[model samples]
Target: MIADTFLIVTLLAAATVRGAAPLVLAALGGLFAERSGVVDIGLEGKMLTAAFAAAATAAVTGSVWIGLVAGIAASVLFALLHGFACVTHQGNQVVSGMALNITVSGLTVVLGYAWFQEGGQTPLLAPGARFGPIELPGAAALASLPVIGPIYREVISGHNLLVYVAAAAVPIVAWLVYRTRFGLRLRAVGESPGAVDTAGVSVSATRYMALVGSGILCGLSGAYLSTAHHASFIRDMSAGKGYLALAALIFGQWRPLPTLGACLLFAFADAVQLRLQGTPLPFVGVVPVQLIQAIPYILTVALLAGVVGRAVAPRAIGVPYVKER
Candidate 1:
């Protein structure tokens, strides 16, 4: 009984990390864009488009690498378009983002029908085209060690490469946003674009660059979803994770470390729900499936309602830049 309990706990912990990986990427992407004063509500659209591109390309070429490249390219294109409308033309950021979201949601379905004729999904990828868990070197050799070996194997190792990438991003983002000159300028641009402009920086350029970075991260998240987490892209496969990422950003107060914690919190809730589903408890006979699915979203609303504290956004966020002559 004790061994079974230990095994269940370890499995749930690993699952939480898995569920949080994409959210971490998307939340970090949102952080970069918003830190540069760009409201990227279109993260959903970019992710959806990238997922389709990745799945379709992988299905065709039988190469996840090519699919990853295609996905990032597609997302970068969409990000540039958003930049064109919001940064260049000074369009309403929210409206433009929503429009992009609507456009991509429909466009993917149409393209899927035309290309693969699978209604709205791309063709299922081949074994070589999908990413699966890779057992690390020395993983087996260490299993005889004490608690550390088993914990390392179950929670820290055995995930695909993207999981490690997501884990690495936390420190990288922290350094980029807090330790670099460009990070200083990026934050300044978001808080006070006029000041950044007065300091001889191009506000549009900074924001556009931030959007590009955002695109890369979002694309990575999408590719992981289609190629690593699942073997194919399903219609609306993102399943509102993009929005959930935004909530995580909000809950984290836009900081890299805190935002990571927020993502893991949501992911942990999801893992718990997965474990609880159809399980009998002391008081509860069996947990409902719908309630299990809703746990993470319910936490989102609670967080947004000030469960922890007020989440303050950047000062000049969502405001378009107009250079003063």
Candidate 2:
């Protein structure tokens, strides 16, 4: 019984890490964009586009690397368009973002039907075409250790390459946002564009840089969704993950460490919900999976609804920069 309990706990923890991977990456993408004064509501659309691009490219070439590149390119292109609309043209950020979401939602389906003729899914990729999990060195040998062994193996290892990249990005982003000159300018621009402009820092340039990073990360998140987490793309497969990521960004107070923690909590709740599917509790008597699935959203809503604290967004966010003639 002890062994079984340990096994279940270990599995859930591993699954939580796995599930949090995309959220962390996507939330990071949104965080950077927002920090630079561009509210990126189009993350869902960009992710969906990248997922389709990756899956289709991989299917054609049977090369995951090429697919990844294609995915990033697609997402970057979309990000640029969002930048053009919200930053250059000074359009409504939320509307422009939702437009992209609607556009991709329809476009992917139309394209999918044309390409595959069997609904909005790409061809199922072979395991070789997917980003398989890596087994860390010394993990097998360390599995014999009592507590540390299982924790390390389950939580610290067994994820695909992108998971580690997302984890490592936390510290890198923290340093970039807090310790670097460009980071200081970026944060300042988000808070006070007028001050940054007076300092001779191009607000457009800084925000554009943020969008670039945002696109790359979102691309990774999308590609990982279709290629690593699953074998192919399905219509709307992003499934509002982008919004959940945004929620995490707000709930985390737009900080990297707190965002990471939020992602983990959301992922943990999701993992537990999945594990509880069709399982009966003493008084509950076999709760429905749909109800279980709602837990994360409910928690996020509670957080956003002032159960935590006022969500302090960047002051200059969603505002376009116009220079004096």
**After best superposition, candidate 1 residue 319: deviation in angstroms?**
0.9
Write one digit per residue (lDDT tens) for candidate 2, span 65-175. 999999999998999998898888888989999999999999988998899876889999998888998989988999999988988888888889889988888898889
TM-score per model over all chains: 0.95, 0.95
> What TM-score does prediction 1 earn?
0.95
After superposition, candidate 2 runs with Cα above 4 Å error = 282-288
Q: Stretches of candidate 1 above 4 Å error?
A: 283-292
Model 1: per-residue Cα lDDT over 185-233, one tens digit each: 9899999999999989999999999999889999999999999999999
Q: List clash counts for every candidate, in order.
A: 0, 0
- Give the alpha-carbon lDDT of every model: 0.90, 0.89
